[model samples]
Target: MPTVALIDYGSGNLRSAAKAVERAAADAGLSMTVTVTADADVVRRADRVILPGVGAFADCGRGLSAVPGMLDALGEAVIRGGRPMLGICVGMQLMATIGREHGDHAGLGWIGGEVLKLTPADPALKIPHMGWNELEIVSDHPVLRNLPAGAHGYFVHSYHFVCANPAHTLARVEYGGPVTAAIGRDNLVGTQFHPEKSQETGLALITNFLTWNP
Candidate 1:
């Protein structure tokens, strides 16, 4: 069975993300071991990794750093080992070079970008972008494969990733102008929206991630 490490560093909707992955795997007729852990050893040993966060960028960053050896373990497992990785919401924000949410906070620098608060050109649009929005896929990335047309992703965030390299942006959604829906490269992929909450579209994304080789 493929082992999946669902990092629990005191900030994310960890259980929901775990259940979503488990359900997706079961529904796809694939068996996977999903371990919700803060243990560095477990993370280092897992075949895949999922990082989920649900708070301020700096807070989440601090929470993640608080776990001893967790940062280095993640680097070993995901970056050096080339294991598949998926970051969700603020978890995805951590992939950026820095986040300018409340203050300037350093991130993983895994992907070249910055997470900045959403500035909708239209005054009426909300800051959180708290509902479903259509995903405009710009690349034929494997994680985005087979998503139905007009596919909408569940979103609730004030900050959005502005990728330094456009090719790293796999999909985008329009909040007021354009917000990054998904960002990815190599074996790493991150979603600004919550797959655990996104109904069919979310499930499809999870399924794709489970089966994606790269």
Candidate 2:
């Protein structure tokens, strides 16, 4: 049994994430407990942390910082304590150095890079990059161990991670052009797609995260 913590900061689809974890755990033959709380102690005690976010990048940044001691707790839990952490959607964007959407804003800096909005040099691609897309895997990471290349996943975001270290990118998806879809470094993993909305493949990804040993 792995206790997965789904962070809540008055943003994004917390309920959906919780349900997805529970459902996936059942399918994975594992026990999972999901909850929404800013309790630093709870976050520190969690086996895996799942950061889910929605809304503007700037707003999510502020919401994360507003959670009292949560920021440090999360940092210590993963960086110092070596607990596994996964970020989804805007949650993924927060792992960057800065987000250039709306205005200049700082990110968690878990990985080098800045978050950038999807803007194609060609006018054919759409803005939000909504719907399903394939993850063109580039590296072998624990979080994506069994996941096949070209796996179709759900996406609903206007921004994506522009990793400074391209090596950190685990998968890339075509959206107007090639965009980062997933990234991983040690115990940290992030997904630009909503795994919760991505069905079986998504569940497998979550299972890998829970079972992976940092």
Q: Highest TM-score: which candidate?
A: 1
Give each model's whole-structure lDDT.
0.93, 0.86
Give the range where candidate 1 is weakest over 10 consecutive residues by summed lDDT: 141-150
* Candidate 2 per-residue lDDT over residues 85-201, each given as its tens digit: 999999988999999999899898889999888897779778888999878888988888777555788998888898999899999987767989898888889999999888877
Question: Which 10 residues in a row give candidate 2 its minimum summed lDDT?
Answer: 142-151
What are the per-residue Cα lDDT tens digits for candidate 1 across 74-155?
9999999999999999999999999998889999999999999899999999777899899999999888899876799989
Q: TM-scores, in order shown?
A: 0.98, 0.95
